[model samples]
Target: MENDTICAISTPIGTGGISIVRMSGSNALAIAFKIFSSKNVSQESIKPRYFYLGNIHTADVNEKCMMVYFKAPYSYTGEDLVEFQCHGGVLVTQKVLQSLIESGARIAQGGEFTKRAFVNGKLSLDEAEGVIDVINAESESELKASYGLLKGNLHKEVEKLQNIITDILSEINVTFDFPENDDEEVTSADVLEKLTRAQKTLDHIIKTSTTGLKLKTGTKVVIVGKPNVGKSSVMNAMLGTDRAIVTSIQGTTRDVLEETYIYKGVKFNLIDTAGLHDSNDLVESIGINKAKEILKNADIVLFVVDGSQELDNFDKDIIKLLNDKKVIVVVNKCDLKQKINSSILPHAEHMECSALENKGITEIKDKIYNMVIDEKVLSQNVIITNIRHAEALSKSNEIILRVITDLQAGANLELVSLNLQSAWETLGLITGVSGTEEIIANIFSKFCVGK
Candidate 1:
């Protein structure tokens, strides 16, 4: 938390086309200038928020790079920041960071830059987490959900609830002090009605967390069937790559093969498992057992079947195992005449595809994605993608409901105000601040009565 200038390799550690080294703090520009030299460029002549082509002198070599300066109060960390975009290489980037460190700047810890942003009021705690999500997002759906938080959607909602709670607490306090023969029961009823409305709002937000969590963590879709029914081909066709080995031999996929693909901005974990049939070999048996266990945890199961063949005992057994799970019967190899009856597979979505020919693969992805996500429903709502945010909302809802119940049961104004104040403070946890000052400010600002 020191104001000392901190530096680190901004880009990922590796040999690439280009790499960036970054520094932030009060002495960030000064420390950077110690090792960087540009023609006609000095501290007095430096322009803030502008890039300067310079040479960074290091213990090992001198690297020609582009350096940009971000002055305090407008930078990412709300302090003087500098970035050196140097030639991409492990040795070059490390040397640039080393020179800054030797010139009196310390290396930055993981997430310290963003944490500093939060500490300096550039971002709230939830928004800070959103920054991490955006950095780590592997799929488009997850990125969209992360942007919702980064854009202050949840923060604004929480502030609204805090304002409501502030108003209620202020009203109760004013009524208690005035005591002009007010109807106590009527006032309590009105407070109870307002609390219920906030509770419902919180309930709706908590409900969206389920989908939000799925977006954050991609759905696991396990594909299981008897071997040699083109399960590997189905995987390769969907991914447009030879991710799994395909052969005409039975039990080719003796182990679980997992890969990920995005369909309509949502990520799905495609798992190819060993054929679900009796195997004499111990290794094959273990693989079959593993596939069965994976199905239990899968968000969705792609129950594959040979479309040109009739139902075998193995297919029936696989169907029975998926009785309680979300399933999509993938009638694969449907280029020939269809022989597999869809009616027998009850309570499952049936989709036909010829994996060998890549026919209907897109439709199956559409079906799997549609089965898990409904973008239309979430289009207008702010999703609670973070577990901590969801938990805070849930805890606030619980406390508010309790206060409502106590109010209905004849709790006095003083007692109800205490509980309501607690609820307001709990809601403030999301934004990393308490409501004591906020309540005092609210009372004076919203009410015109003499204080």
Candidate 2:
């Protein structure tokens, strides 16, 4: 299957300025030349990486297009690659893909191109994941983290740690083969010191997962408050669009409203739930219950309160619900005469805002971002954004810790070598060096076709 020519519509299948149909394999250029006709270019004369204007000759339709080729060993998949930039439209792209398929190019599966790259040693497993992350990134922070992976930041660090292990393993092997030589025998102290360093490196990388995950998956910011407290308005003000209904009448929003916005390169998922209060209406009551449920799972709760009105039983009731949650007490309606005391919500960070006038919204965004994401952690170039990488790193760390324990307990060097080798292979999984076919298939299955 890896030897066959593969093709797919690389660009999104919809109307746009242009859409690219990509192909890679030994027959990529042959398949492209079979269907594409250019005035001055032939398969023998077409230069690699140079674009040529041409007409796509299919059975029923002919369309003007542009074509480019990448020679083998220099292309994205390290094989002969070709791309046809056709007029952007649903039918046009599909027809182009079909034309290629009819011309002996097999349809590329989801992430097949990238999978080929990984198989050809063009990318590490983590770097291939980074390519997908870059494609699906929702915010600047996500893009930065994914780009770091594409640039081989995490791979470099992992390689360094693996090198340390390799050195120790080599010494252990020599010690076993030549017990008579004292210099070749690796001492427990020497192994412990090197393993401890590797452990610290792994620990630091694992710690970044907390903030790294938030960057990849936006922070969940749920808005909860008494009715008509500008909860919906605050959501609108933050989003710069009126996504939720806002009315002077209480209980206007009877269900949860959700929207997402990017602030300072970080994505924030704003969920405006039904106001927290006692209600007789069955639907509103259900929504209130759901709001309470969502509150428990929120990354940060924006407890909105109408500053124009004094703290009432409804406000107090909601405040008590935010027991140990990471919360920001949003005293909305600050333009009106202040009546609600911020000091009442002692458990949360307090900020005043006038959603109607769009005042203090920036401060709210900054505070939320600062509260959740640590700038210091993000400053570190390598972060594990993918959960799989984190899991593998954690397992490798555990194995290394066990090896340390065995050494400390005066276990045999041969047994210690076995654990060390296991740790090395576990780390290799992150780079695809020791990953099974099933794991690799599952990882690529999450990718969209044409990736």
Candidate 3:
């Protein structure tokens, strides 16, 4: 199966300038040569690193294309590769790909290109996961983190930690074999110190993942306040577009309008909901109910207050609802003479902004980033951005921690060795040195076809 040739459409399936039909395996170039017709270059005459202009004649149509070849080990999949840059029409590309598939090239699965990259030692599990992240990134911050991962930033950190763990395990094994030498040179306290340091490092990485995951996935920011308090206006400013309907009439926005945007390397999902006001209208009531539900799951509540109006009883109700949730008080309509008292809200950070005038929005973004991602955490940070890497690292840490606890509680040396070996195996799974067939399939399934 590893030696089987694979082919698929690399570009998106739609009208565009061009589309790519990619093939990989030992005979990628041969399969491509079978379908291409070029007067200037023959399949046998084409070199390993040349592009030949050609015509792809299918059963129905003739498609103009460019054929490029990459010989084994230097290619993306670490095998002989060929790419057909053909017309962008969906039908034409499919016909060309199908023609190649019929010529001894099997259709590549979703992410098969990258899967081969992993199997052939072109990338680690973390780096492979980053390829997916780069394709799926929705914001600037996410793309930066994904780029870092793809470049092996997270892999280096994980490998370094694994090396430290390996050293500790070696020491443990040496102590177990030579009791007198262990007593003369190193004590159990030395082992405890090493384990404690490793545990702290793991804890730090876990903490960094909290922020990294948020940046990748985005923070759920819900805008809540009384009706006519400019919640929709604020949403418009934050999104830099008017996605939500805004009018002078109260309850103009009777539904939850969500828009995601990037600010200073952080992604936020700004949710503008129906104004938090008592209503009998069924539709408005449904929207209000949804607003409350969204608030429950939100990472931050942007309580937008109408600065030109006095604080009403409903404003107090909103404050009561956010008893435990992270709240950011936004005094909207600050361009007008202020009427609401900021001192009333205790311990909540207040920012004056005019969503209408596009004033002070940057301040709001800055505060959100600071509150969610602490400066201290970023000081010693190498975050596992992918869900798979985080899960694997966490499991490895758990196994090692369990071993340490058992040893501290007077467990046998062999018991500690078993757990230590298990931890190493868990870490190996992250890099595909030890992984199940199902896990590989599951990871690849998330990729775009012909990735």
> What is the alpha-carbon lDDT for the whole of candidate 3?
0.83
- Residue 441 local lDDT, model 3: 84
Query: What TM-score does candidate 3 reach?
Result: 0.91
Ranking by TM-score: 2, 3, 1
* lDDT tens readout by residue for model 2, 118-186: 999999999999999999998988999999999999999889989999999999999988999997778
lDDT of model 3, residue 203 = 76
Tens-place lDDT per residue, model 3, 23-113, is 9998887777777889989868888778888888768768888988888899888989999898899999889888987889999889999
Model 1, TM vs. native: 0.88
On a 0 to 1 TM-score scale, where does candidate 2 land against the true structure?
0.94
Global lDDT of model 1: 0.83
Which parts of model 3 have CA positions greater than 4 angstroms off?
A: 174-187, 375-381, 405-412
- How would you encode candidate 1's per-residue C-alpha lDDT over 245-343 as one tens digit per residue? 999999988899999898878788999999989889889999999999999999998888999999899888888899899998889999989897656
Residue 379 error, candidate 1, Å: 2.0
Q: TM-score per candidate, in order?
A: 0.88, 0.94, 0.91
Stretches > 4 Å off in candidate 1: 177-186, 409-415, 434-451
C-alpha lDDT score of every prediction, in listed order: 0.83, 0.91, 0.83
